[model samples]
Target: MSGYVRPGNSQPALLFPFIAGVVVVLSVLPLVRLAMTGLSALAAGGAISVLADRALWAAAYYTLVTALWGTLISVAIGAFFAFVLTLTDIPGKGPLGFLFVLPMMIPPQVTALAWVQMSGPSSPLLKALGMAPPLGSPQPLYSAGGIALLYGVQHAPLVYLALRAGLMSVPRDGVEAALLSGASPFRTFRDIVLPLALPGMIAGAAIAFVSCIGNFGIPAILGIPASIYTLSTLIFTKFSAFTDRTFGEVALLSGIIALISVVGLAVQERALGRRDYRIAGQAGARATFSIGGWKFIFLPLLAVLLFFMLVAPFLALLAGSLVPAYGVPLTFQTLSFHAFEEVLLRQTITRTAFANSLFLATVTALGLLALSVLAGYVLSRRRDAAASLVASLIEIPYALPGIVVAVAFILVFAAPLPVFNVTLYGTIWIILIAYFASFFAVSLKPVVSAYRQLDPALEEAARLAGAGFFTRLKDILVPLIAPAAGASVILVFLIACNELTVSALLWSTGTQTLGVVIYNLDDSGSSDVASALSVLVVMMVVIMMLLLEGMAKHLPAGVVPWRS
Candidate 1:
């Protein structure tokens, strides 16, 4: 009697809540399983404590080091690019901007493969230029420095996107006032611009650090060879390596990592509390400054950064895919499309992986959109203790990395439970659960933000007119927030498509995705096939983005702004 009742609809409104409840249960099953596993392990003579020994400590140290370095380098390069693109009249700015940000679209494994091929002693550039010592062997590809370089290059574009938005949000009037007051450019940036943009920088840096720490493929491909390890790498090892099938240990380490991420999130929230530096105002014309004397210095520096970060790796992927083998000299005669053909035709692996990736991504996107919209509505409209608690609990996954979530899923789903006889160990169901847990925050954030912007009076008016909750949601909120929801779905699909960490660990042989295929090929020393798969995955992502862009033009204006 207290629930929603639709007037015009044939079906009862009770069905909606029932469906929603079922979806929530299905979505949260993996997390429940993980908790059970961890608890079970904890009871078994300190299984959790034994796993967090010296090896894990070392991994934590290295993870912190690389994440810090990567975040620092990413911030520097991203700030420079953001400044150049927004404030300077650089030549080919549009094309350069696209090129700079494109790396972020490609999966990290592809970038790692490209660097591995290029840094080889027999690389065309090194060999032709005689840069490699004749007696020296090929340089190792998996050193800590190499991992840092890949991390920096891979995440630079993420920083760029964040800072670019922040740069555009700076009030032109403030800058004009500073300049008119005889403040030099450097002084103005130091005094006014940076302080205003500090939140964006911190947000970008925190994202980069979290992402870098949670990354599995880059370190797996580049760091594993050198015996360098991170928490993500260790998680993968415990899950996959035949020698290390200690589920209890894996669960403990994963829980610890999740706890660390949670702590970081709390700290960030506390640090940003009551800080009102967020940009707010009507739109104005973008301000540009002349880079008269420093164009020479600034342009070349940006070019070099872009080259190493974007161009070099992609080109390496292309070249490696064409060449028959890794560390081999490239020539017109030696180049062939054999790798591509093999990946597409001869090997069923790539095709199957692509199909699986597409399926999982689609389902995850749809599921995330539906759940997020409902949750956002409840949180925004109700504002009660229960709703607030649920909202906060929903965010737990965001702090935890994909690798940890995957491990947690494995820990929970592999054990015997009361209701389900067969565990969800090797099913596509586990992958879907992991995807939701890892990316649900992304879908929820935009919807929640958009919901907050809406005036409560509109909804109150609708309710006063006898508009039921479902009717108001369907006729009012849905249309207004369609764009936000659409954008959220697309972005979630993108992340799920390129997701390697969680998928790599949770996927069974039958559930292989493009990310898994590429990683497997790379691990098996089939660099050419891996490169080809990487290129194909990138193309698929581009196609998906194009489709989303087309769909976006039809959406409301406010929704489009939140796409990035």
Candidate 2:
């Protein structure tokens, strides 16, 4: 499993120690503290209080039910796109894939807000179209089904990404051989492709379930109003209403969330672990099946999907932004930019949020880029259980929900530090540290994948010529992996800039982020301003994605995730 490392070319002496230190600080320490806190709470009879509460059981049940349903929806939508885009002659695959993945990148609360504005009684867009329901009518999205639907929408891209990776690895030779044996396209797909792709499907489902269970934004926005509480939102509510037991109780709650996520991951492992689904082939999978005239049907189907998933809600958000008030209709005469003015100019909090978010994102991206490069190099070269364990540790913080990570960090940093006695509990520094811990996995993956593809002979040769480790990396490795590194930086920046759940809990007055600002605007009855802000954020996301799309040509395949 090692990369092209030549023997006798040892890694830098301090590399392993540095990586381990980072893992311990970012991943292991906070989680260990969380577990300890929860165990302590249980030992102190907090378990009796927590376990005996009907609310806790209800929240857990709701979380599992919604996550399961969301996983099913995600798999269905994601599988359809994965199969079509990877295996068939679909037109505009690149653009379609990119658009389909956009919903996932857009914050879940934003998606929920946009959808809420697109329907129901108070929908400005719907009201303008003379299609809104009566004022007292309940919001269609403020229910359990609504939460599940939005969860699916927000997470389907994950499934698409996971399944598409496996689908891309399907053997072209196997497909061709099956065709030569007179197996029809349908038979070949069902008999060979289906079985081979099952692992990917299962893995995607597992990931979707974890994501859904840990999702705070969707459930917090949709479920809470309807009296449907998921574990994530329940944790938020508990924190919102602070108490003496808040820390310990939240620790227990976070443990539950972590336990559920771990089980899902474990199931994924068990499913993929038992099988050696390796195949022999010269060429990777390609679009072997041409749908021909059926593209007519499929094209419209895809267009409709995109319309609902991206176009309609965005239009509603735009319309809501233009309206003078929440329920006001948008027209040439009534269109207003007051909301934009309020968010971009008048609101000091919003301005502070923008600055804080940009600062955090830039720092986090650059910081992780540096660490990921070092870690990636070491990980790619070292084929040992220790390296694997380190990689998994890096993944733990990321795999758990952002809220859970935030809680863990809070527990770890709530007190003043040892020598400095400086506190990070209510500062931007804590948020930055959490971002490093949470998004390290994102920054490292592409770099590691790029590193694996590199030829090790150059580095070895350079080392033999008396070049030091940094010198060899600068001369040989850096230039070759520049594109992937650039992609990693931008990807982390995009994610960090819009992150809410982590910052939501971590932010004090001055450290508000874009995500928190938007959520706050809407919650404070300034839907128009929120919509306006969401519009800008959505624009930012689109621009970032387009930048990545432009870089897709130069970057390694799969490094730009939305690209095929």
Clashing pairs in 1: 33-412, 34-412
Ten-residue segment with the worst summed lDDT in candidate 2?
Answer: 1-10
lDDT of 1 by residue, 402-464 (tens): 887777677667665567687778888889888887787778887887788788778778877
How do the residues 383-413 of candidate 2 rate in per-residue lDDT, one tens digit apiece?
Answer: 8999999999999899998889999999999
Estimate every model's Cα lDDT from 0 to 1: 0.74, 0.90
Error of 2 at 374 (Å): 1.2
Each candidate structure's TM-score, on Cα atoms with residue i matched to residue i, is 0.86, 0.96
Best by TM-score: 2
Cα deviation at 194, candidate 2, in Å, is: 1.6
Q: Show pairs that collide, candidate 2.
A: none
Residue runs of model 2 more than 4 Å from their true location after superposition: 1-10, 274-278
